[model samples]
Each structure stands twice: as C-alpha cells, then as structure tokens.
Target: MSAFLAPIHSWLFNKVLLFQDIEMDLRNKYLEIYGEEAREIIEETKNYGELIDRTKSIEELIDLSNIHGWLQNKIQNGESRVAVILSIFIDKYGSDALKTAEDIFYNNGIKQGQMAKEKENPQNAKDIFSTLNNYILEGMPCDRVQKLIQADEHIVRWINTSCVHRGNFERANADINLFYKLRFLYLKGFVSSANEEYKFFETNNEDDYIYNIEKA
Candidate 1:
C-alpha cells in the first residue's frame, strides 16, 4: 500500500506471475518444485493465452481462484509440523526460533533449488501471478494432489539441514505429512507465523465462506 512496500509487493506479484508463464526447462523446474496441483495446472494451460480463456467463464473463474488459495493452503499444510516444532522451540527456548530458522537455511547440504528460472524472465512472472490472482478469489483452484514421494526429497533435505545445524535430532525426524499445510505466501503475499494466536468467534457470510483477515 505504501510506496516503499509497493516495490517489494510488485516484485513478489511479478515473481508469482513467473509461476504462471512457466515453460521449457523453467516450467519443468516449477513442475518439480510445486509437484501435483501446479503440474496439473501447468499441463492444462501450457501458455498464457490458454489460461486467460480458461478463466473467462464465471464458473471456471472461481475454480481458477481456488488454485492459488488452495495452493497456499496446501503449502501451509506442508509446513504445519515444522511450524509446530518451531512453536515448541519458542516455548522452550523463547526467541531462539529466529536464530534457528536462519541457521537451518544458511548452511551446506541445504540445497538451493533453481529460483533463477523465473527471475530471469519477467513475462513468466506476469503469467504465474495472473493465474494465482484468478484462483485466489474463487473456489478450489487445483484439485491435483502431490504424492508424498514426489515432495520428499526437498523436504528431507531441509529437515536434515535444520537438524544438523540445531544439534537437535528431533528436527531431522519431524513429520512431513503435517508440514504441507504451510501456505505459499509468495502468491498470497502475507507471511503469518503459526505463533500468532488466533481466537475464534462465529460469523455468517451467508455464502458459507470465511474471508475477513481481522476479526473484532
């Protein structure tokens, strides 16, 4: 919203678009990185023109919107267990979680997957974000489910890296199934820690969906 934040937001918006316009080797990288739903969506549209047409119909439009939100939800699910572990760290070790996060990501054996594919091409950025936006405001976007085996390589790597750096064996053996819930905030644009306490109160949107971020 503010001028300073706008650039970073715009950059991320475009970065997400990179996912939509993905093609060739780059697209394959995304397919590998995102796994099932992203692969299905990529297979369905292949190009920006196809995605645009697919999004034109009202019914189709909602389905597309769900793709982005659902993807984020999926990611949030993926990272949930890691988050819970982090929370326990916070509880037991206080603010040491921040240091832990840095150490985990900043070391060797922590593989760096190819992120340059999208960053090199701006058009790809636009495409990914457009599809991501289309999916955010609608129903479930991607029905594709990623196989546990498909996502495990990167998962195991990160988990091990964290474990080795923290000197904590439990981190290496942490559950993977529960971690997929972590949202893809690059597309969603908000990074909320699971530590943020949430208190629930009932609400009726009539349509039976929840959208409001802040509840009073």
Candidate 2:
C-alpha cells in the first residue's frame, strides 16, 4: 500500500484540495459581488486546469501507474488556476479584487493555523513550523523549495532554494511580487493564530529569500 501511494502522496493531495477550496471560495465571493459578470470573468480565465472530484480519496482518484507525475500535474494545475483567477480579478477590478483576495487568503490561513494548533498542540517555533507545512502547498517534497538553515527550540530558519509558484504566475501574466504580498498576509495570519508568542518574517540576503520563525 505504501509503494503505490504513500503518506506524502496523501499529504500533498490534501494540500492541493486546500488550494482548490480557497480558489472556489474566492470565486463564490466574486459571484456574489459581480452577479452575472463573474461568470464571464471566470469563463475568460478557464482552461488553466481541471478540478478534481472531491468525493473520492486520492487513492481512488490517482493514476496508480504514474503517481508522482499525476500528483505533480495536479499541483501545477492548482497553482495555475490560482494565478489566473488572481490575475484576471486584478485586471478587471483593480484594488477591490485584490483586497477581497487578500482577505480570503489571510482568513483561510488563520483557519488552517488554528486547526493545526488545536490538533497538534505545537509547543514551540519548530513544532509550529512543522504543523504549518502540513497545510501550505509548497510543491512535492522533492522540489526542495526550502532548506533549513538553522534551528533551536525558540527559532527555526530556512532559505528558499527555489520557487514552485513563480512559473505559474508568469504563465498567468500575474505580478509575482503581488503573489508574495498576499502570501505574506497568509503567513502572518497563520503564525499569529498558530502561536501568539512566535512570529514569521521574510528577509533578503544577496538575492536569496530567508524565512524565519522565532519567539516574539
């Protein structure tokens, strides 16, 4: 059973589902705001990827013969869909769309963070970071998007080895810097709820991105 679809496979699938859920929530919000206009906005942004059948488990839905590629495709699909939606919204409605999207990401992050804290009882910065990773979509583990630089009981630091979302954003014609801004909101919300005494910060070090989680 482990060979066909391991725990990490299921873990990544759940992350994909989380992104889908967030995207749908953003879509529904637009639907309510724009009424019939949203249909066309969403339609114009279509074909980035297909949504999965929510009723089925990953084991039931995955292509067993090409498990890695299948999961990778879904991850890319999810990333592309998000970038397109955000891009389209910003182009059509400007700051209004951006504000709504920002709220959705931050609220979802807080929700995930609180759930992680309640379920895992994370005691320190490292524990909080581990639990947060379970919810955020950072591509497959093999991508090595982040590498741990240092860690102690009170602090855990990592450097971005690569970015998985950049290509999708570029393909969608979205502002990559805006994506990071929205993502920062999500992280801020997550850390605030995940642990009140801890904070998450992003810094630049000679063209590299550094992420730090430590006690406040």
Measured by TM-score, the strongest candidate is 2
Deviation (Å) of 210 in candidate 1: 18
lDDT of each: 0.28, 0.84
Please identify model 2 stretches exceeding 4 Å from their true place: 1-3
- True-vs-predicted CA distance for residue 191, candidate 2, Å: 1.3
TM-score of each: 0.23, 0.93
- The digit string of per-residue lDDT tens for model 1 on 182-212 reads 1222212320111112111213445322222
TM-score of 1: 0.23
Question: Which ranges in model 1 have alpha carbons more than 4 Å from their true place?
Answer: 1-77, 102-120, 123-216
Every model: Cα RMSD to truth: 19.0, 1.7
Which lDDT tens digits does candidate 2 get at residues 71-187?
Answer: 888888777778888888888899999999999999988887888889887889889888888889887888878889988879999887878888878887877788788888888
TM-score of 2: 0.93
Clashing pairs in 2: none
Q: Can you give the lDDT of residue 127 in candidate 2? A: 92
